[model samples]
Target: MLLFLMSLNFMVLDNIIMLEYNLLTINSDMIVMTILLDWMSLLFMSFVLFISSMVIFYSEEYMYGDLNINRFVMLVVMFVLSMMLLIISPNLVSILLGWDGLGLVSYCLVIYYQNVKSYNAGMLTALSNRVGDVALLMSIAWMLNYGSWNYIFYLDFMKNDISMMVTSYLVVLAAMTKSAQIPFSSWLPAAMAAPTPVSSLVHSSTLVTAGVYLLIRFNFAFSNNLMMLLLFISSMTMFMSGLGANFEFDLKKIIALSTLSQLGLMMSILALGDYKLAFFHLLIHALFKALLFMCAGNIIHNMGNCQDIRFMGSLVNQMPLTCTYMNICNLSLCGLPFFSGFYSKDLIVEFLSMEYLNMYIYIMFYVSIGLTVCYSFRLVYYTMSGNFNYISLNSLNEENEIMLKGMGGLIFMVIFSGSSLMWIMFPSFYFICLPLYLKLMTLFLIMLGMFIGYEFSKFSLSYSSKSLMTMNLSFFLSSMWNMPFISTFGINYNPLKLGNFYYKNIDQGWSEYMGSQNIYMNLVNSSKFLQILFSNNLKIYLLLMVLWFMFIMFTLF
Candidate 1:
């Protein structure tokens, strides 16, 4: 809380406080650790600290009687510390400490449930981010050419040098995998298998946003061509997640998909040369998404660990406060007018429209926005409306004040954070002048998506299900473009097959044919031949001894 408040102070002052420590000097090269205390780092640090604190507080009710509560809290603390390290450091070498810490801590958090699902999700999360870690390590190596590792001073100047910009490409790759963009997006939804608080924090900012934040910090290094490439990938990621969420039924996974979509938005905007707007969206997104996850955790708890939306219905009757919280967060997620999400999201869309982009990019941007609204409303219909669908014996009420209080702590922020952040982050307004239709297009899409979602949710009217018609297409969308299959089977299948072949053909088959077994047979055959020679020699010596004895006896006579 103190750190969060301090961020406001830092933002108002408009000053960057950089602290440098020369850790070592070898020959002419020096190893200096740098801490940058600009508004961006401070603000981001404060947001992380705030969200982590709330998550810890919320876990008191969520993790109530767990045996390893202390261990869980410690891991969360470690995660927060790593995020702080990541936010403050300007040097790539020092930043690795935080970068790797997030990966390790998140894996621990993801596997906390002690189930096969949790373990699988944890491995996917860890291994997917490993790609980014390797990319960052490579980027650090490239940055060594800049003499000093503090890239803050050099990224802008080095953008022109093609040789030096290899660091830029590596940085982009790291950001892509870290943010779970396109090819790497499968892990984001899989991470939903983690505990809700972990999902809330990780999805909000700690793990996934690490890439976007890093890119925001390194935005100056991206050339136009690089930015164009990033924009395309980010746009696709946004579209893919939105499509996936609509097809998704699992409550937490849908929210997780929403997180992925928003991340794509942040990255796309960052690529479009508005790092500050991206930061604004990032901060506001952290607030509402965290709250959304908490609400999800509460609902899942009440439903007796049931996370499928189809099993939830008329929740508003029993848990009005939670339902309300969930709806507000969902609305915020949809960028509803006057909501916290709208402040940042609206500005981003307007700014994007102002840019000179091609047809494909433009179409993706609006279509993704519509899909986001469609999914949110679809989720609303499934979980909140219709008849009571949950078990009648179960107790589903909002008696858990600890959870509510933790959630309440962020309600004010989720509602008003947009305008407040806009004032602080962007004191100057962007001049967005478009004809009335372009401005109204966002509203039109929202209405259209809401209608479509309502129609789509009414699946009972037609027993002949539409998904049954094109099962392949639905599967493709729901699986995040078959990325999970590719990440798991496509990647592991060949290596595993080759390993099996080697074990059968070489270790078992060839060893018996020409290795140890063959060597033993050869040894036995050689010994038998030598034995035959010795036996023959023995017989010959015996005969010679008899002949000599006979000759001696005759001579003596």
Candidate 2:
């Protein structure tokens, strides 16, 4: 209720509120904590808080009977707080506090289940995010040259400066990692090891979008060259995740990859200089994505922990509400007309089509959009239409009032957020008049994707000889192009091997023999000699003193 009111207030007032405090001053430079609240932050914050509230409410039933429920809730609360800090802060240093907090809390959440898979996933998530953390720290150091950590103020000024351009590049690098673009994307799907609520919150609103929000805030610093590079990478990320989602069978993982793909869309649109549209899509995506995860959680809870799509079927008859909500979210995700996604997605496509971009980018943009619809419909058919494939003893029912209530809040937003935000965010919508063929390009691709998805979902590839013929390709797509393995084992393999080498040759062998072991052996021998000499009594001591005196006299002579 508070978030709804806040959203309304921000929409009506459209005000900017700046809050700042100087933490320290050094050599006439101020290290300050700053919060810049405008329509963007207020609208995003309202969405974040609302989605978080729903996720927490849903977790009440979804995570019921767990011994660590309280801890889980606290971690989630902390995650929300960190995200809030990230959203409000305009200062780089202050943003780091939130950024690092998010990485840490998300790591904790990912590993909350005390299993090997969760542990590995948590490590991958943390280490992958640490790349961005380092990049952000570097950006902060670079921004120090400007005398203030507030990159928001310096974005336009720094555009022409070479050194600041480097900082901008660093900022983009950081955003890429946090947003899970390209090499950094492996952690996103792996992070589905976390509970569903965490998936909904982190994947949808807070964690993944942090990068997009950062890029949106720093859009002023982006050069033409930089934007092009960003566009290429973001397009690949979108296409890659979309393809990966199509191959995925895990319920939560499919959604996670979809989040990744949407994040790429957000970044790509931002690169296209439509930060407002990117922001619009981010918020709308959050609404449906969160609700989508909740629906998945409800289904997972009812299906005895099975997440394979093959195990789910005819859920529309068995669990009408869950299916209804899931279908709405999925359709919205597909950018169906009149849904929240269509408002922002349609605008982005139209604007892109009208832009003078190269064929590569144009193709990627349309193809990825089609891929989006493809995986979504494929998911819908497999989960909602087929015959039930679960074991005989499984109980599939939607009797959880708390879960339904949690979803009830988001269903309204999922249906209306895009339209409402369109009016509020862009009061004067400019018409982009395009040729009929160009205008209908998005619709054509969407329909084509649906057709392909329907055909693909109708048969199991495993039953065909072509499955063996394309086993390598299937494995690549299903494994997200071996990204999980690369991020998990590939990242650690060399480091672990180096550490082992050092332990064997340096710490245990060379360093031990030359330093600690040698010193210990020398000390032991000396102690033994001293004890033997001391045991020889006063006569020996007197003789030694006389001999020492004679030797000193001889040396002096």
Candidate 3:
């Protein structure tokens, strides 16, 4: 553990020392500082090392019996290195390189279990991350045409308009895809098939954050006109993921969605130009999220791989230490008072209440925060309390004492850290403190969620066909909340049958527009053009011959 910490520090120093030449610098005309290592990036970097180190120590015990422990450790190290490289890279090109490497490392780590489901999840993550990379690459390619690509490198990117309208839109798409926003979020839920430590790293401090980090890296390009777009998209992501988390049954999926929603909150803060608040929240999230994920891993390890919370209950009595740590972490995630998440989460809300932004955005932020509390508590209750039907009491074995000790240490540190220990250690990092009453209010929300969650657990869940039918009926009824007419008149009705009845005489009508994603796929796979251009080696040879002939003719002429 000491060696690991030392190595982590060494890695940070190596990066700073090696990349010193290309360190951040300001652009000549831009108002933003060109190259600056403000508190935000530094703070995020600190969290990365902190959470990653925790993962390594926890895994020492968690993966003790596994055969591929060395590979796991190596990949974990590589993953950290890749993320650091991405975070500290000087130019857009280096950023892309590191980003791609991080993506690949994460995919490899996800499938480390070597099962069909794990492989499938890894593939999904890869495909989605590829979409993000393609957007980033396209932006880089655009910069190539304008001669400004090299001029705005590293932290210096803050000083130039490297992103034009098209590039900005593309980068935003990349951010959405990378952050698992909206429709692109399907990949993250599936990503639950990975080991829990990987989930912690992916969710808390690493893979999922690359896109938002990039956005922050180029804040100058976005600070003026795109604030509204960023805010709307981010808040909507928070709202959607929070609601979706409420509906999730898988423990890791719930946490994964929570990760996305929290990141959306950070993005929202960034959009509002509250970089300090966003940075603090990002740091605080790393602490609580890592704690949460590690606890989940312990649960999975102890319960012999159970995932669905519907089957779990009475675990608090069985694994008291695990339960205690998990509960505290859950409280933090719910933004309870004196927990790290409280101050950070409230700070974001405070920024949103600044009156210049749309009132609804502020409302949505609070609603999402409340829903965040709801789902986070739901995660704890469904997994930790109730009937012990799902968990095999006979089969359950408490995790190693060392693992439990690590979790305990984290909880204690976060509690003290949240209070004032961390502030004493780094006074410069503290931006603005929350009011005591506001902190109490944050705890009130958490306590409210705890009560609601407790009430929910008292009712025995019935999986009988009748109960399932009721659930289906309820879901069908509630689906109308978002777009009532679409749910009632369009989706519930068989569009295929309706179109068949009407367009039976008319060729494909709605399907044409409906399959635009497929159309994009088709355009991407246009083999006919490839065939005409290079299907045969003869075509390539002939083209080469013509080019040579033209060259000779031009020389002679």
Candidate 4:
């Protein structure tokens, strides 16, 4: 039904439906709820719902036998609803509601397992997202300068206003947090602590993409400096994630990092002033990434919960269908020709090459593209080839019909979604007239990455004692440049130290001496002194009373 509606909406791209109502009125100002539905919203909503439906179906088996399966499914549904709200909302207030919903629901989903790791990961996810929530709120407050919270009405007029540039900065900050760009990226891999289905939904389609979607919508408002800043950060994020994925040992984290890298690609393109291309890649990425996670989930389920790629090998002989699907997703991730990913990714690189960019950014773009292929090939080599490294007696059969059934639904889309969306969304193909060197840069990097990835993964570096020399560098790359530690402990360490200092010096020392305790003690000593004076000396007390009476009589006179 959603696909049908989306197709129909596509046919009438000129028709836009707007719905607005006053939720609150204060004097002359009002808080209004606004929804804008054009082809973009309808198309994105259709894709989100379709992917969500498949993920929910996949969860039915993947989450089977878990104690809170129903709760899990409900949370996933709520996530989709929040994403829909985000998609349709043109009002800042309405977007906040959806944004907060995504953060809250995702935190709940991340901590669903109720374990220590889940607890930590959930905290990281929630707090990191809270930064974006705050940024969105700030943007909304700033938008009040335009007399309306609905930014869509004013984006064009306000684009050149210096006062309105702050709102753009805040919006970009919010997008960066949701998308997990650079310093805020640790939570994404941590979020893999959640169940696989949740990972598929959150990482692939909904939560992470919310930021990119925002940038796409607000692309008109960005200043040149802002775009350059975003371009640099996004390029760094892409390079960092791609490098980290090559060193990661856990299967899901590698995939999670890959998602992070692709997100950077999307943001970089958006910053390059091509919102349509960015949106195009965002949709294509969602399809194949969701399928990739499902395939990983299937492999994990069959392997008795082992996620280490080192423990997995020769799946071709064991689970042929699952292996085939896994290979398709992996190859598509590497942007193999004619696959869903190639259509969007290839176009993005070509467009970027044609742009008037510096050599630094130009090299970064192609090198990041190459890094993507590198890590992907490394992942494939580690998991899909070589001898079976698991225990020999393990039954690694792919007999779960429900799981396969869920993945089967996406297989066709994984192959064709790119081509279909391209024709539907773009009126005409982008004509790139770049030099041969620039045009073939992506292909050359891909081949180079493949060779480097094969050599890196195939050779064991630990055999030589000299390997210790690069241990620090190796650890840096493997630990994602220690971003998790920096974001978590590094952020908390200073505050905690200062808090302890204040606790001891202020709360226990000066505050105790000079606050209520000292005041009470002084009062007690004064009262005792007065009581002794009255009780121990009756003559003195009588004299004091006489004096007091005389003073009162003098005042009256």
TM-score of each: 0.93, 0.90, 0.73, 0.91
Task: List candidate 3 stretches off by more than 4 Å.
Answer: 1-40, 145-163, 223-225, 391-393, 419-448, 460-557
Question: In candidate 2, what residue range of length 10 has the lowest lDDT sum?
Answer: 460-469
Which candidate has the highest TM-score of all?
1
Better of 1 and 4 by lDDT: 4
**Local distance difference test, each candidate:** 0.89, 0.90, 0.71, 0.89
Query: Residues 66-117, candidate 1, lDDT per residue (tens digit)?
Result: 9999999999999999988999999887788999999999999989988999
Sort by lDDT, top down from the best: 2, 4, 1, 3
Error of 1 at 40 (Å): 0.9
**Predicted candidate 3 versus true structure: per-residue lDDT over 1-557, tens digit per residue:** 44334334553454332223434546753222123243344556666877788888888888888999999989988988888767665356767777888889888998998999889778877887788889988988876656554423432444345546557667777877878776576677777887788787888888888777877766656646677888887888788877767766778888888897898898888888765556567667777788888888898887778777887877888788888888887777777766777667765665555447666896688778777888877777776766687623456657478777667657765665454523432345535455776545545666666676566545645567457776875454223123323423353479767778776443455655457656866777887667666767797898899999999999999
Q: Order candidates by TM-score, high to low.
A: 1, 4, 2, 3
Off by over 4 Å in 2: 1-14, 22-32, 463-469, 499-557
Candidate 4 has its poorest 10 consecutive residues by lDDT at 460-469
List, in order, the clash count of every candidate structure.
0, 0, 7, 0
